[model samples]
Target chain A: MTGLNNKIHQALQQIHAEQALKDKTKAALKQKIQQYEKQKYKTEKRRLVAILACLCLLLIGGAGWFYFTPATTISIDINPSLEVGVNFFDRVVSVESYNDDGQELAASLDIRFMTYAQAIQEILETENITDLLSADEILTISVIGSDEQRCRRILSDIESYTAGQKNIYCYSAASDEVATAHEIGLSYGKYRAFLELQSLDPDITPEELQHMTMREIRDLIDSLSGNKQNENASDTHQGAGNGHGQNSGGGNRRQGR
Target chain B: MRSEQEVNKAIERYADTVRRLCMIYLKNETDTEDIFQTVFLKYVVSSVSFENEEHEKAWLIRVTINACKDVLKRFFRSHTISLNELMEQPEILEPDHTEVLEAVLSLPLKYKDVVYLHYYEGYTAPQISRILRKNVNTVYTLLTRSRQLLKEKLGGDGLE
Candidate 1:
């Protein structure tokens, strides 16, 4: 029995030794291959990277022209009043100021819009706006809703019609209704009409109203009513028929044109 | 200087990856050595640089696997060994454990590759896809089929 136990122990030891040999051989062979690769690789591939670096630099330099081209500097080079006097019909819808090196520094707008009167009694006392057709200071504006919710449909019209195979970038006055009402230059009626019509739009929010530029609202309302060029006729017609079933005839006219 | 030193250390760290990949393809020590050299040589030749140590480790593992396949194809045409003999050689180390490992080795090469990478090398099915350039679904299917075969090779009454 002791001899049999001894034999079993010997067999186990032999198995363990064989396993150790198997593992070592496998590990050594892998190490030797890695050593050979490490020795040859460094010597062979040294110059490849410098060449790649140079190629990368050339590509980046070529791309910088688009990223860093001087912005189109379209400012009022003289006093805007003088520029306007010299070119009256130019209308100077947008003014872009430039730096000494001709990079666009800032953009300003000097388009004509209505003079606003305060709303009736409460509009006059609480918020006294004297010259309804007057100038207001503006920093920046866009044709999209100020909060990025909805835009005047006329933006698409301008892109499709006005841009017409030409790719020049300009800040347009959007639709005829907005521009015409803006140019009418009287505040109370336009503002009142804007409030009345704005209330009628299903999706209009007071937040959208507060952020809206006079020009953007004018464009949106006019485009919705469908007479950008005929704001005076439409505003008067809308005012006269407001809140009565009498406007039902005009509702038919809305679909007619 | 620190990054370069880290990269070299990272290559040394993923040494098991090269071993398991070689073990899946080649039967003997000499063939494993050849595969190891080829995989690292690929790492040296690759123009793509990595962001950190982890990236370098992953690239080393993937390159080793491809090199192992290439070496096996180049060799199998010239030298043929029975699958049973190849599977039995590792028995000298652990006769008790040889059943599972041998069953794995006897699987078809597509199933064997996915099993080895998934189990021994610790790659997830998604990582296996990038390494083998196979779809993720294909790797999952191969793994499931291979496991079923292994269960059968173990020869139990489970498949009723």
Candidate 2:
């Protein structure tokens, strides 16, 4: 068995040795290996990109949660004050005050889970606001940890509430426009008017402009510029509708066209 | 994964062995070439760390056999060219060893596989059993039956 197996082995070896793999086949095999390597690299890179994209999405979601969240604390200071802490749904969580007058007012008012607008109206009615805000006094309204849009909307609401009242100017500290104007040594109301007047007629009298609100001065400027009854009557109406800060000048500054 | 240079070296060393195994199992050039490529491509893509060159060789043999089996299962078995026909074909098998080679090829696949691994590859029965995933007793039985068949086909005389 051993002798015959050896001879058959030798014969098969001769047969095996005689046939060689063609050069083309060897080259094709190498090419296949190279292709496989490239495919593996691409798969690895795609996996890494997918992981990074998920991480980036997580980071953006976290930042957005931190930035655009609505405020929990709506601080209304008619000095005698009112501070209300609310949730994202605008339900009042707690109401507290630092001063004795504010404490007394906070105790008297029941603003729990009340919408901020309702709470403000309730506080105004509950407190003797006339005594709290006497002549030569301003009310400061600030919202903490909130986006600008919500803060400005709430500020506008409060400002409208105090509009016809005597000796009350609302300072909306959270408003960007208001804060930037205050930084530049002008109240938000006056600065807004300055911008409007400057855009309308650059040479409009900027003198004693500080004493006028946006609407009073815009109306004064409209009467003086004589463009109020012009062909663009809709534009004039739009301006009147959106006017902010109405300060009464000494009289009217409508000097005539 | 094997590097390009490492893969190239492996192809150089083992391409002929794979071809020989395929040739022994299948007689068609197309089938042989198909299995040859599959075996090498699988080696390139496999992440298995071989213990040594012998282990790698055994892996290639086993994969080539499995790949051939898969192809056999996938397609209807075409009639393989008989060794008598191969011997008659010009410039195919050398005339001197064609008789013994034909005798080996004429056996059944089960017997021929053990014959090739034992005689040409020089593996022991235990080693053949491991490579072919058969019992050692089964491998020894197949080898003995194959020898008897080869001797009977070759007129009961060993090749000179």
Each model's lDDT: 0.42, 0.63
Model 2 residue B59 lDDT? 92
Error of 2 at B16 (Å): 2.7
- Candidate 2 residue A248 C-alpha distance from true site, Å: 42
Prediction-by-prediction clash tally:
14, 1
Candidate 2, after superposition: displacement of residue A3 in Å? 2.9
lDDT of 2 by residue, A218-249 (tens): 46557666766661364333323222231221
C-alpha displacement of A115 in model 1, angstroms?
88
- Residue-wise lDDT of candidate 1 within A74-120, one digit each (tens)? 11111111011111121222222222211112222223211111101
Scored by TM against the true chain B, the candidates give: 0.75, 0.89
TM-score of each: 0.35, 0.57
